[model samples]
Target: EGTVYRQIPDLIFEADYKDRWIELQEAADPWKCTLPGELQEQMKPFQRLLFLKQIKEEKLITMLINFIQESLGQVFTEPPLFNLNEAFQDSTCTTPLIFVLSAGADPM
Candidate 1:
């Protein structure tokens, strides 16, 4: 009589592989339907539940567009032109004015 070892069935290995794949998917997209902690806490319970469900069902880009349009309406308005020379005239002014321009757009 020699040593006898139990061999694991291939099906068991396949099932374990599937389980690990599912776990990896869950780990990868942990924030799929989550809101920032403060915003979630501020929402009413029933509204929060519905919003969570709806956001999961909705296309992310669509939700982002709606949020930007509804929450940041002022961004669509024309920005006020600044008189840079007058703004920097104060000797005590230590703040820097930064310009964000599009490609090929001259700052001057």
Candidate 2:
């Protein structure tokens, strides 16, 4: 006979909690703006795919960071004096993937 293992139960939050949180979010950003239709129409198929890919990648990185912090009880820090040129030049070193979280608009 095979041994049976019990599955872990999922977390359950209060009823209406999700709805109330969503309402608060909508109230905070009532505009609920999105990419302009004109700009979206102008984007090529590849461009649209690339944009979606970038968003998915951002979400993935955030989840990974959160998981690491929760499991290890420590936040990961960016390495100091990270030289892109040197990293790329090394044959043994794997190229690191970089995601731009934010960038300030250039002054006119």
Candidate 3:
């Protein structure tokens, strides 16, 4: 329905708990496999897809928030966490629903 964070379960298996950039980047070519050539060259401006995906990863995200908070000082509280609905509204968005999991099965 919305922008799919991912389709392949393996890519998402531990993502909610741990960081996955180093792993996914290393999974293939690390440089080109996940991204296209232009984005690799542009450095600042990125492709929409990569931008969306980047907003979702935790490590990259925290770094972004830290950068903003560090620069903005007391005004900013935290960095943004990737919420399908929130990215548009919340600017200094950290402390998102993350690093968590649910267990056991419920009969469907």
Candidate 4:
């Protein structure tokens, strides 16, 4: 049998930090209206905080879909134009639109 062991993150080993993380998790609502200080600091390097700060639960799905579509149209795809009239020409068809992206190009 092959077994693998991994070192745990230092945060989990510290009693105070572990307790604080648990407390934060318990207190946070479903949408995470407020994030813990440590997590906020970690996200800063990746600019995740900047993006997350403006998020609203109600519009999150629409915003994500729009972001993906916009990124595909602007960055990943060539000839960035989507003809809505052409796409919906057949009202009876229920075929979903799928994108065939090039290698290393992810709209998300």
Candidate 2 clashing pairs? none
Model 3, residue 66: what's the lDDT?
45
Q: Residues 63-98, candidate 3: write the lDDT tens digits.
A: 444445545664686455657567445544564444
What lDDT is reached at residue 93 by model 1? 43
- Model 4 C-alpha lDDT per residue in residues 1-108, reported as the tens digit of each score: 111112124544666566655654453231343333354434432233234334344545544444445445435433568776776774444676666899999777
Better of 2 and 3 by lDDT: 3
Instruction: Give lDDT tens digits, candidate 2, residues 1-108.
Output: 011111101101444344643453344222222323232345443443344334355444444444445446554534467666876665354656554554685533
Alpha carbon lDDT of each predicted model = 0.45, 0.39, 0.42, 0.45
TM-score of predicted model 2? 0.23
lDDT of 1 by residue, 3-89 (tens): 111121342346545564344334433223343323334554434434534434444444444454555664654377888787677
Candidate 4 lDDT for residue 23: 57
* TM-score computed on alpha carbons, candidate 4: 0.26
Where in model 1 is the C-alpha error above 4 Å?
Answer: 1-76, 90-93
Per-model TM-score versus the true fold: 0.23, 0.23, 0.21, 0.26
Model 1 earns a TM-score of 0.23
lDDT over C-alpha atoms for residue 81 of model 1? 80
What shift in Å separates residue 33 of candidate 1 from its native position after superposition? 39
